[model samples]
Target: MKKLTLLFIAFIAILSFTACTEDDGFTFTAKPDPEGISFMNQTADTYTLTSANANNLAERFVWNEVDFDVQTPINYELQGAAEESFSSYSVLGDVTDNNLAVSIGSMLDLAEEAGLDNDPETEAPNTGNIYFRVRAYVGADAGNVVEQTSNILTVSVTLPEATEDAVELKRELYLVGDATAAGWNPDNNNTPIFRDAENDDIYYFEGRFAGGDGVEGFKLIESLGNWQPQWGINEGAATSSDILGGDPQAFPVSDDAFYSFTLNAADGTYTFESIDASSAPTYSAMGIIGTATTGDDSGWNQDIDFTQSTFNPHIWYINGIEIFEGEAKIRADNDWTDSWGDDTFLSGQGNNNNDPNIVVTPGTYNVWFNDLDGRYLFIPQVSE
Candidate 1:
């Protein structure tokens, strides 16, 4: 009888649980807030993107907080895309707050992708419009959650040309003065410094230099017969360290040693490091050969002999030579025994008679070749 009574009590409990919500005393239900998400910040019609201020703040997007009538956390995101399109939008930022800040660098990347540039040579328009908007969603799955989007805004962007104060890096530089074979004469067929193919502001040269005895120094000139834009350090000391330039004064050689040199035209600075060349090979003779040079036979049968540098046994140069539009190679003894050609056409090793021929453009040029590293350069006499 006690078991029957217990079973009866359990049956009543089960009925109560089944009928719980239908006759419950009270309940709570979530409702969407009518005050939807929207932008609350003033925006400009146009903005400029520049490398100088790349890291600086460009814009701050502010929006009103969104409520889905829930106590849980809310997620916010800022998006950008080509004007009027979100098919390929980029999430510029995501945060819990109602505001997000963006940098000029980020916008610059977008402008580049939009085919906008500051270069005058390009046909791309410097000014173009991009779209931006903010989104508020309640949960991770924005599609199934109470999601609201802010009004899309258009922003005109412009990439201004480099400023007037920007430094101009010339395409070529020449070594001259008492420490070099040119001996202070600008027109003496000075050795050409190799300009970096990837970076116009950087230059490099490695060869023999004389004079650490205090009086010998050198300077760089842009053209063979011109010296007004000369570059050299003010101090005449010879030692390896950081260097300053811009003055017509001479940079000291520091010692009668083989040195590797670098100059940064953008910052008016240079460096001279004395390097050991004991392991470097010196060829008996090297000259320009291939279709780029000329003789009666023309193409590969001709050779333009290069003058061996008196300062270094492994360095050779040819001044004011017309390098025709063809392929060229620097070889030893008028033959291909030891030949150098680089795909970059800037520098590389001979690699056992294997390498790509140096591409040439027709121009009157001063050519310098370093047998030590198989580096070569061709500098035009006149700007083209």
Candidate 2:
């Protein structure tokens, strides 16, 4: 019984040793062939296919090629048929089930044959912002497979419309004040009082004029005493008290000359002037004038009138028949009152108070203010 027990123990030890040896027989590890894979024909002028493994390996390759415009056919082939001793039957055989001892050349040739070469000159259809992907597969071992996908690639081919060229036109007016006038002086002759250098096809005028004072009130008289073109004068004499409809006061005929000019590209400057000599003479005022057709005066007159008064201080006026283009207008009486005051009216009682801003187009415009003191009125130039 002791001997039999010893024999049983020996048998168990031997079985344990045999099991361990079997476990240590072999260790199989799989590593991808680095040189066996690469992308081919990656250029704008050519169609390309990507291969996963370039290194010689026992593997099977599957390929898919897509074209945006045309259908493509592809085929795979082994590299070395004779030297590798690879038979045509074995090379062309379906290696899908077998992972070991496969041909790379046969696989590559198969892919190329399937690629479309028809109409080589024809351009590929635009993908409309689309991309492509490639993948490679290998059967590392029985029931074991490995796959590598290529980096995504993109293509672009499109343009934009050219910019349009434009032409610019500019109009400007240079104004010179009457030499004898104490005001209406714009220091620079080169830089006109108004300029449309931006070529907006508009006219503009801006400057300062001295009018309104007790001594010899200034007037923008359009027509001189005789209504003769040469006899016209823009500056004249008046009294602040007279302008306010107060008792007439005699004062020297002051030569406080005023000036106005007109400008057009084809024709140069046209100037006019006038003076006031009436029983009820008034003070000089500041205002604007423009064409009646441009509709720029907010439905106001082309020859609107405006004034700033000394009585209430900080006030201006706009009153007259609608003229010009309606592009501009005088502020409402309320606005004037809010700014200056009702007392700012030239006539203390505010009678016959017509002040309005004037606007004109690109052409000549007849401009004048009512001569409360006389029949003569003045012409002023505005350029934008």
Candidate 3:
């Protein structure tokens, strides 16, 4: 009787151990999903990235931490697409933290890249919908990954007009002196200090310098190429930390290698930094010289020069101009070295400088010249 009772107790203990093992062996077949992913601080209305708030923080996207039920770190990536299908998307960045902060400049770039027109002015403003999604993944690396994407969010974006700010916006600085290609004449042949097309207040100049020592001095001037307002080393500042106007000290360089100069107009400071050979754009500025007849052939004989659009070096524009069916052409400094015209001037199709002069009918028109695509357009407006 004692032996039989002992056997029964051992069998019951074995059964309890088996039940515990089965309960602990359960596993999840799929990776965990991130919950409550959203734009925590985004505005409901269309966001505007203007000159005033370009550098400000634009948006913060937050999401709850996901648990993949595995002993590994999870990676998060923020992505955006022009369409909801997300056939192709741009990755804003990756973050291990639960929230991601994006700048206004970054958002503007994404909007423009996704086909938002930069034109600030129109009867109907240019805008488009941008979709955003967050993707989370886990594994040692991308090779052994299990990824899940969040629900899509749509946002409307408006693009600022390029020409609207082209005049008032000081997006470029020119280096003028005997040391520069312009040779001390701010009004002629000035070498430009370029700013990123999307960036504001930061300018860059990369080129060979023949002089930087005391022999030939260089000053920074706005695109007007005038010396009235200029930038130079501040008085009694350490290592040229500040820029000042009114007969300021010129910047000195080593002049050993091709130099790159960066001026932060926003901070009122400047720096000399090294740059790659292919860092800057090689596009040249163009001038428009043409004849517009409102009354007697008054302006016909004179060469009317168009100013370079402040936002785009390749774009030239003439605003509020009188036109009476005459002739017009685009040229460099009113010289035939580089010029453009069209036999079919009424048609918007682009033509090379070698083409004939464009014929027009009498009216006031706003002209736009695009050197990037060799295209030109004439839009008529009521005289004011």
Candidate 4:
């Protein structure tokens, strides 16, 4: 009787354990949020886009979060398309956050895509409408998953007329001399002066001019190695010049200082204005870090160091470096104290504000960064 009773108890215990295990399994039925996701704020009737404030925030789209009635993570995406079109929608952003910030430059780009242009001669309208909406889904979209889409919203954009005084720069200028980072070697992959966005004929750079005992001057070259169209000071004092042919006198520099150089190719004039650095901040290093660069783990785990210009501490570069497929950002001193991730232009602002990361394709590139104005350049190198 004891043996039979013991077997009965053991069988009962096993059945109870099995029942508890089944009961502990977590599962829930998914139902769409009672309050469907939609834009919480109304968009402005019409937005005016201007290049003057290209880096400024154009809009911040916000929406109500959806409760999918499940424990799985839900994803959000902002979609944009031409008015009255649901297909061919472009992803403005793919983020988990409920809000996404768009810059004025992005709005201008979308305006151009909508066939709006500032050119008066073109038949394309200077104003148009863009449609936007929010999409929410869970897990990888394999076509079987049910997704929620918010009601499409409309926003109009207008581009101002271009100024008639705009001048196009035909020539590219490079720096060569001991006073610059390339030093006396004109073939050291010399740095090119940045051109003004509005006025292409105007070029500028802010850097240190380390004066030496001999040849303590700098000159602008038209191209690498070939210095026929070189520029220097001859007719006037070192403060300004109006000559640009047959190797003019090198601009004189007696002491090392932070100088802001500006050249107006339109009028063939230039200036070197010294800046006092008694209170200005100095950085020991700067670098690029992200999924695009090869780090220890190839994410944000490490940074790919960039060589700071010996002449201009504000300038940083990495020549002929292979960048992987992903996005990245520029930060200072191996720290996040200052960083730039804006992806508006090749030579554009690097606003440290919570901007988007710099997206890049897989290719070898010559990367350049200017800390002064938060401008960056990524030029694809020709495969040899």
Candidate 5:
């Protein structure tokens, strides 16, 4: 009887343990992971990059999108590197819609950024293989995120050729010597030649100069303080042509006069024009005169004056000008001596005697004129 009771107690303990195990309510299963990505368009062909092909689309990188088994948005990034290991790499582009296209110019820049030899003239291997890959990642939450990387691609790239126009950049020109108003001080405001806003290669300087005889002659300096690269008139030439350097002789000016100097680097020509100060058109004060006027404006007969900004004199403004379907011209001092019409209005190149009128549609605009660069723009004002 005693042995039977002990056996019964052991059976009761086994039943209590079975009940405890079933009391726990959860069951676990693994979440689905994204599939591996591969490039659809990667090839073994070599691509030769040149300055001519810089603007052309060189390669398109396409990849399969990651499927996280749920509707989770993924961000994809295209990466590039010089080494296959991709220990150091650059994010070329953010892959939007599963693909990215890079231009030859952009790839060349990427190669340079990857520490590859960019100089085509150098003996170093200017051509090499670059590796590329794509990385896809989900949100920053560690608990619910997935990331995957694509297979690496090897692409051959050649450095761009060095061309005359490609290598040479226009340098800032400044005036020096006794002929300039600044008298050899480049730091002074009057010495720096105004670079043409439309064309950076063109430079302009207009001011009064006391004639420098042979000893006091003036020369164009690349920089105000440095004198290495200087341009002066070739021997016995009066106009800006055949400029020479390296022990250049100063172009002699005979009389003190108002001068307008234009240097066209692209054209390889320079011109020196002497002007009478009184007869020359003055652009100091500009006024608007046109069929398009504001606030009971007299149509095309009188001037609608522009007020100069106290902070910036070059900036002129006329508020609430109701531009009509007609045309207009910007004049200086309410006179036709200096007026810009049509294309000339877009390019503040002084008054065009036979300039076409600037056509405008009906809109109330705040007219802005920048005299320093000769650009006129209109900003649409909210209708009152």
Candidate 6:
């Protein structure tokens, strides 16, 4: 009787073990954390969806179909203020081998595949505002699923707004002697500096040469024009009074005549000096002192003496001397036949006498002429 009882007890224990084993297969339990569901509203809009948890579902938490009844899956929708909305759903691999707990890493991978892996706390739209939520499920079984919704995360973006300032200019002038005599307002205290139309920041000064005729007197001309602010005695229409009749008119021979101007602004300053050479005359010589003709052989002919003239000549001279001290460095000496004379000397020269061109930075400048002709300095307005 004891043996039979022991056998029955063994049999009962086997049955209980079999029943427990059968109950373990494919059991679906909604996990606390959804496996693969993500949401993002890059646009200025709000979005919401149901998600399934797979914390303890393991491999049974296979997502068959993610239903976003109101929203489409893996779609980008444009919203106001250049914002966008997006949703994604993914199925994680079977977690059955890993017991009842589904790996968080797997859920993250599934979320990434579904395009819902973005961080909800920091997710933001490019402009305007955004809101996001998620939904998940297990396999195709609606009965075996869990829904997890994240808090609505909002992000705002704003667009940025063109720029203006004061004008600046830099000017340089080349001339003979100091600039004060040239009628240049160094500080623009007397005359206002003119600004360029194209660029208001640029300023220019007109250089005028004091000489004969309109060309002989102080005439403000363009830099590219035929005249310049130099102090050479030329034998043409551009000749200064000091060069024509030996008597100084606009510029005195005793003191070197120079051009000068002042700047109104205190930002910076520029200095321009004229270069002198030997080809052009610095001062004019009276006909008497430097005779172009001599008396008759009998010594009875009329001897023209410019020095004896009572009237002051308009010629350019050096301290009552007939000879000019300064000359032009760059000279084009040529002979031409005129109606009144033959073999006339014609020369073309530059103020600097060295470089034909010069570049200056933006600033105020005191322009001056050295031992050069005042009619050769060409100051032009420039822009960059």
Candidate 3 C-alpha error for residue 377, in Å: 40
**Model 6: per-residue Cα lDDT over 297-347, one tens digit each:** 321122222221111121111112111211112112111110011111111
Pairwise lDDT winner, candidates 4 and 5: 4
Better of 1 and 5 by lDDT: 1
**Candidate order by decreasing TM-score:** 1, 4, 3, 5, 2, 6
In candidate 5, what are the lDDT values of residues 185-222, reduced to their tens digit? 64553244555545555667655566845546577765
Best by TM-score: 1
- TM-score (C-alpha) between model 5 and the true structure: 0.33
Which digits, one per residue and each the tens of the lDDT, describe model 4 over residues 185-222?
77788887775544545678777787757756888876
Cα lDDT, all candidates: 0.72, 0.29, 0.59, 0.73, 0.62, 0.27
lDDT of 1 by residue, 268-288 (tens): 567889999988777778888
Local lDDT at 44 for model 2? 31
Model 2 spans > 4 angstroms off: 1-170, 174-255, 258-265, 269-328, 332-384
Model 6 misplaced regions, further than 4 Å: 1-5, 20-127, 134-145, 150-154, 159-384
Local error of candidate 3 at residue 231 (angstroms): 37
Q: Each model's TM-score?
A: 0.50, 0.18, 0.34, 0.47, 0.33, 0.17
When sorted by lDDT, best at the front, the candidate numbers are 4, 1, 5, 3, 2, 6
Write the residue-wise lDDT of candidate 3 on 1-384 in tens digits.
Answer: 999999999999999999999999985444565463444333335665554446744555666667766766678899977778999888988988766756666777767666776654545446777778888777645566787777787877766466521222223356666566566777763545545433455555555555545645577765345564566665522121111212566666555335567676554457775444444343444555455443345544556667774433555667657766567777655566666776644334345656777777666655665554355655545433
Candidate 4's C-alpha runs over 4 A off are: 1-172, 197-199, 212-216, 234-245, 294-301, 310-312, 324-326, 359-362
Better of 5 and 6 by TM-score: 5
Worst 10 residues of 3 by lDDT: 236-245
